[model samples]
Target: MRRVIGLVLLLLSVSLSAQALSWAYAFVVLDGRVYEVMDVAVLDDDLGEVVGEVKTMADDMDGSYYGDASNMYPIGTTYRKVNGEAIEDVLAVEDESGWKRAEYRHDAPFSMRDHLDKVAYGFVGLGLVVFVMYRFRRTR
Candidate 1:
């Protein structure tokens, strides 16, 4: 019973840790408000290393709408982390160099980051399987 409880706790801790590391954040000024982006990336040279982000917008008077940026933002624009507010509520965007600020906006989600994480997990899982199998065969 004790061993089982300990194992469960260990697994829970690992899952929580993995969840914490899985998401990445960036900030941009879209329109006028500041927004914390769930995912962002530097565009390739072919795209000019500049990205035009399309974000969702809403106001009290106007209904929710989607807005696309007219200007392109550099991929590596620098941003500083902000504190005081809850992590989820705080948007990390640079006012000057990191990123150009516009109104608060929610950009289209980036999937490449998610794909990369899955790929990394795949390689790690493969490596562990090979190592375990080798050890088992050696013992036999």
Candidate 2:
């Protein structure tokens, strides 16, 4: 029983110690309101790197009805970590009163930068595999 409890504690600690993914923030001034974006990227910090992304509209009312027919609406921006490897996607949808709603997917690895790099390498490997297959097919 004691060993089980110790194992459980160790698992919990490992999960808790996982670093948070860092996100890049992009800001724009639109109609006197500041709109900020969150996307995957490397964040400079003492702990090395962090990754994740977010977009925020400040001091704005939260409602969908206010968006109006005009397309001056706030749309989510796309973010790619480690050049153009993994993409962190976000979308903005109109809510009850012209308010923009943020919907995000939180399934990517905690280290956006590192994971993105891995993605890059994976793509390279995939490309090589495709090339080899193509060459073999052509030879046959």
Candidate 3:
């Protein structure tokens, strides 16, 4: 019974972890400002040329949520569209660039921080506690 409970708990924990990662947002630093990314694009070099676009415009009511360009990715100075008040923040530009391909996001989760280190520390602390308890009970 104890083994079955532990296995079930482990499965539940792993599923919850996956859910958290799935909802993780990708951030983009634009002009020294960081924005939550709901989408990504791949653009051409210098002058911020559009190498792709969204064939069908997204229905964004609260604010704009679409663009007509693309970019390699964020970091080290890259050109990408963001949902904000900018003259260039339009669903479809006059020049028109189609979505080269579905812009998928592939970012390192918790990579920018010491989350892994903290988790490791937690495991080590837990192991030490369990060991101490076991040793005390055995001696008693």
Error of 1 at 19 (Å): 40
lDDT per residue as tens, model 2, 1-140 = 99999999999998887563332432432222223333322322211112322242222332111111112334443222233322233223232243232223333223344356679999999999999999999999
Which tens-of-lDDT digit does each residue in 1-140 have in candidate 3?
A: 99999999999998776421222343332221223334433333212343233222222232122222122232232333323324123221212242111223332222312355568889999999999999999999
Per-prediction TM-score: 0.32, 0.23, 0.22
Q: Model 1 off-target regions past 4 Å? A: 1-78, 94-104, 110-113
Select the stronger candidate by lDDT from 1 and 3: 1
Cα-based lDDT at residue 91, candidate 3: 21
lDDT of 1: 0.42
Q: Which candidate is the best by lDDT?
A: 1
All candidates in order of TM-score, best leading = 1, 2, 3
Better of 2 and 3 by lDDT: 2
Candidate 1 Cα RMSD (Å) = 18.8
Candidate 1 lDDT over residue span 1-140, tens digit each:
99999999999998776421221333344333345544333122212222234342222232222333122233344333333333233334333333332224444344354356679999999999999999999999
